[model samples]
Target: MKIAFVGKGGSGKTTLSSLFIRHLAATGAPVVAVDADINQHLGVALGLDEAAASMPAMGEHLALIKDYLRGTNPRIASAGKMIKTTPPGDGSRLLRLCEDNPVYDACARLVELDGGAVRLMVTGPFTDADLGVACYHSKTGAVELFLNHLVDGRDEYVVVDMTAGSDSFASGMFTRFDITFLVAEPTRKGISVYRQYKEYTRDFGVTLKVVGNKVQGRDDLDFLREQVGDDLLVTIGHSDWVRAMEKGRPPRFDLLEEPNRRALCTLHTAVAAAYEVRDWERYTRQMTHFHLKNAHSWGNERTGVDLAAQVDPGFVLGEGLAASA
Candidate 1:
């Protein structure tokens, strides 16, 4: 299963993503946690020290990736010629998770998080070179490219902490996950984000569920329920332990309050349930929609390639989690 956590900034999506990764790891599940957010704090949240958290960002290695993938292939001459989400054809590169490949090690260094049952990867922090530029687009495009070619088995999982706000919609990143947990507080701004996300993704065929966070009492819960209604999947009550952990204490999943633990379990169950509800036709349609939407940018305008025709012919809804590469 590939899950993404997205919400307005400070809505606690990163915190929930870290905790959920910990929960899966503790259960002996095969999991990969990705800190795709530009802020890059999922490392610390996953119990890594500052030094450990400071791994290479995949964005910084785009040139190497292009060289490795294009490798003597006459079709693709440069990184700009490659489509991030298109599957590799004959003589093109294919990337498999945990496999030995030319770019795998560098990619692993950038994406893999250390310690625990869950492997971690970060997109890396923004640099001074990025000032006054939309360089994060390249960073996120690296992540999208990585995931585009990655192959995972039925028992494996990928959890990504996406960037805050509707910025993710700027790229096809919104279409990459099987389930997107949108964390929202019981406030107007929070609910506004939910509305924006819904409007943006309504036609994308992505499964969206609201995870209410920072609820203080019944009123907060009531507000969330009223705003999100059937879309609200679960509520995580405020926790002092989480606050303390953020303030420099070591993160101990075992010390999570009972309510929070229950919420995590509920989230896990919801994700599992999502796999059972398959709609391949809709999935394919949405995939085509985004492919066509970006056709001019990633295809004709640059490489003169028919990008829509490059959509994975074998792609099936829910199959990403049910089959091996």
Candidate 2:
């Protein structure tokens, strides 16, 4: 299953995303953690030194990735015409979690965490050169394309720490995940994004659940419930362990407080239950919707081809490789 953590800038979404990845990894499950946020500190949070955590950025290798995923798909025309929202067709390559593929070999790194080995992939950070010349979406498009081509199965997980705030809605990337955990603090600024995200994704049939972060007492929990109501899936209290980890003095996952640990378990249970309900039909429709949206908006003009034709009429997502083979 694919899961995403999103919230306001200071709402601890990155920290929570790291904890969830470690929790899933400790269970000896196949998991991949992606730092899709512009800030890009998920590596340090997972206990890697700055140097080791800095794997090759996916953004820098867009052409290579496009070429590999495009495979022999006839509808795509060429790698140059493959936009970020392009869906895989009959002959396109599909990826499995931790699979030995060219894209994974080039961009993913294996790191040992508390429970087990977890693969880490990063969207790369906004460099100084990108300051005035580029938009962050161009860099994050790598993640969207990766998710588009990936076909994860049962017991396999992909956890993404999305960009802060509703900026995630800037592209079709927001619609890529199975579930999006909206991490909101007990602040107006925090829940404000939740409202914005809810409104943005309301018509899209997204399974959005709120995870209350930094809860101190009954009042904080009450505040979250008052604002979000039943949309709150779980609440993680303030943790000295997380604070210490942020300070560069990391500790064992077992040292985390009980309530926070339970919260993580609840999240895992929710995500696991979601795996049973993978809606491939709806998923394909969404992929097509965004592909057409992009094609009409800019892709056609840029590529001089009707990108909508790239969608394979009979191509099913999870069985793409088998069908193509």
Candidate 3:
């Protein structure tokens, strides 16, 4: 399934995303981990090296896409291949600086990597970097290459480890996949924030689910149900395994930890079951919403998608704050 991990900052989205990557990979399916949060570091949580990503952003990528698209923007034509940043042996920071003048560059870079579509997608933050990446994506053949990777080549699963709080990937015009999950602490604000995303993504024709991360007490769980309707929401309790993982520590999920192993097992099962999701219709039956202003034009790489029809420039710009948050 096409899956994404989201929540307000420090709600364990990255750690959960990393664990999910291992969980899906354990099942032997190829997984693609896409890091969609510009500020949060999935590479650190996953223990990947930064040197893996070396492409220049904005300066080169944006221009490339604009030129290919026949745009007369001044930044589009003046360029030779710029210096590619070398991975820093730590994937947390790309050798290339983060400047998402045009956010399409992120998508473009991933597409250019041979075998970019793996069973797991280990990617970087979805930022201005993605703008230049967009330039690369303008070419139909390139996009087709990436889309084919997601489709026919079929990377077993796609895991987007998003930055906490608001982010560009999350704020984009339309939801991009089969399942969109909201993860939050059980605090009053957390509950409301979880619902906010659940309700917002639904506005764009995307399925949304709630996963209560670091949950505490029966009362909070009960309140969560009351707030989100309790149908299929999941509760992930506090655990040291998760704590250890957050500090770049290893063997985080020790079976001996009182409730951790059990928690991990239960959470893992929930993730495994997420593949069966088909909830877009059930959740949005009552809301009077339209796709975010530009929700119509965001990535529609999936087959048989007529993206032009979904173009909503205002919606797209409106979402920039949401995406960058």
Candidate 4:
């Protein structure tokens, strides 16, 4: 289960990425949360302290990772080059003000595998230099090799949270992900970005879905979901998540988690079934009925959502594995 989230900035892309990671972590699913966004908020979402990444710095860092793999000890790797992201006036100012080697403290927390899920790497948020010339420059072939090591070598699910714009720097990486979630807010331009991004997918065997995160209403939900394909459409709402960001605190899944958890579970199951339904010939002929079953399952869960809905409904709502997961 390799998952990635894409959407314009502030569309809840990072929040969903973190929520999914938290869920998988709770359910014993090992997950790698890749913060590919240049803004780099995934660490903030996960409540992990990490340094702001400069592409120049990242490119420099990659050189070290490669050299270290070859038995060279680079001193800069230990010097800890990093910067502060927290707004001033916060109480944490004194705790880490002007600290060097901030990378160690302000870096992606490789959360251990607790159950089966692990949020191994939370990354991205590089400076413009990372996007302008250096990130694309390819660090002596080390970047590609390092990326392959992350994608090909992972034994568990990997989730990538990419930068917000088009031009394919990050979207090009979509080909390797097992499943892709195209997130959109209510604006047509947002959905349009998702549509264009979808056109560039060249890889086969990867499933794509649309997630309507933080919708203000149902019209947008139905519009996004009705795009006419086998992909799953998951919708969530505006949450205390915004408040959490303002306060620099992590979202307690217990506090701001959504009613859509079961829906996502159903989605994960649907995707697995869709994958193993095996017999593309049979599936093509039967996809409508298959999709309709999923639609029914999804519809039931969408009916009752209050920021405070109890968990009892989903327990009865689950219908066993979509086809035996």
Candidate 5:
């Protein structure tokens, strides 16, 4: 299953995501964590050392990626010209995650975090050279492309920590996830983001679940319940352990508070339940619509190409596939 955690900047999205990843790993599940945020702090939360977490961003190596994927196919000349969601054609490239293909190998190296059951890959930090450039777009685009091309096992989990705020709406990043956990605190600003995200994602078929974070007592939980109501999935109580870990204290996932651990387990169960829905036809239709909309807006206006025509053949309009496309 593919899951993304998104919310207001200080809403503890990263914290929850990291804990969730660790929880999955602890249970012997295979998972890959992608830090799609510009701040790039998921590594710290994942217990990776500073240097290991600071690996090169995939956006920095687009040229190599294009060459590897395009191969002998003359249709795509650059990564910027690649429509990740577009299905591969006669001469186009396709990728299976963890496969031995050159493109897969290169992309794996770019994002893979070593030495754990749960691997991590980061979009890297924003640098001085990114001044005046749409750097965040570049990172988001890279992740989108990678996800679009990846083929994973049914049991495998791909969890992404997305950038904060509504800026992600500018791209189709919101549509890329099977479930998007909107971590919201009990504050007004946090609930405001939830409203905006809920309204925006309603038409996209994106499952927006509210994960209440930093709950101190009954009042905080009450606030979230009042604001989020049925949209609320679970609540994570305030953790002094998490606070201390963030402040350079020794790390210990095994020592997590019971409430926090239970919350993570509840989230895992929710994600597993989502996979059973299996409304592939509806999902394909939504994806096709999104592709067509983007094609008209970006492809036709900018490149004179009918991007919708490139929709993957495997995703038939009225048919349900046994596996994910």
Candidate 6:
């Protein structure tokens, strides 16, 4: 299952995502974590030093990634012709979680935590060189391309730390996830992004759940309940353990607070349940919808080809994936 964690900046979405990834890895689950956020702090949150956290970022190697995923698909004449929303066709490469593949081998890093390990990938951080020259979406597009070609199934999880606010709506990346956990604090500013995201994704059938962070007491919980209503899936109160991690003294997963730990488990359970409802057809439709939108918008002019041709009418993600497996 592919899961995304999104919310306003400073709302603890990154922290929550790291904890959830650790929870899954410690349970011996097959999981891959992608840091698609502009801040790019998930590696540090996952207990990797700044130096060790750095890897072959997807954005820095976009052409290589595009070439690997395009594979033998006749629709994509060249890697340069493939845009971010280009969906997999009959011969396009499809990736499985934790599998040995060119994409993962080049861009992913193996980080051992408690019971198991997690495969980590980042969208590459925005740098001074990108100043006034590049938009963050260019980096984020690598993640969208990766998701477009990925074929994850049950018993596997791909948790993404997306850019803050409604930025993901700029591309089809928001529709790529099986579930999206919107981490919100109780403040008005915190839940404001939730409202925007809800409005943007309401018609798309996105499974958007709210995770209340830094709840002080009943008042905060009441505020979240009153604001988000039934969309609130779980609440995680303040944790000293997380604070310690923030201070640079990371602890083991077993030492996390029981209540917070339970909250993580609840998130895992909710995401796990979504695998039963995974709809490859809907996924393909979403990809095509955004692909055409982009092609009409700028992808056609940018690549100088009819990008709509990239969508394969005969390709069924579920059927193709099963046969490949």
- Total colliding residue pairs, candidate 1: 5
TM-score on alpha carbons, each prediction: 0.85, 0.97, 0.56, 0.59, 0.85, 0.97
Q: How well does candidate 3 score on lDDT at residue 208?
A: 65
Highest lDDT, which number? 6
Tell me the deviation in Å of residue 132 in model 2: 2.6
Model 3 TM: 0.56
- How much is 179 displaced in model 3, in angstroms? 1.1
Per-residue lDDT, model 1, residue 271, is 83
Off by over 4 Å in 3: 49-149, 152-155, 166-174, 252-325
Candidate 1 or 2, higher lDDT? 2
Question: Each prediction's Cα RMSD?
Answer: 3.5, 1.4, 12.4, 18.2, 3.7, 1.4
Clashing pairs in 1: 111-121, 112-120, 112-121, 113-120, 113-121
Model 2's lDDT to the true fold? 0.88
Report how far residue 86 has shifted in candidate 2, in Å. 0.6
To one decimal, what is the Cα RMSD in angstroms of model 3 from the true structure? 12.4
Q: List the residue pairs that clash in candidate 2.
A: 26-115
Residue lDDT tens for model 5, 198-267: 9998887788899998888899989999999998999988687788868857356778888788888889
lDDT order of candidates, top first: 6, 2, 1, 5, 4, 3
Q: What are the per-residue Cα lDDT tens digits for candidate 2 across 107-165? A: 98998977798889999999999999987888888889989888887788999999998
Q: Stretches of candidate 5 above 4 Å error?
A: 67-80, 89-104, 107-116, 300-304, 312-325
Model 2 TM-score is: 0.97
Q: How accurate is candidate 4 locally (lDDT)?
A: 0.46
Point out where model 6 deviates above 4 Å.
Answer: 319-325
For every model shown, the clashing-pair count is: 5, 1, 42, 13, 0, 0
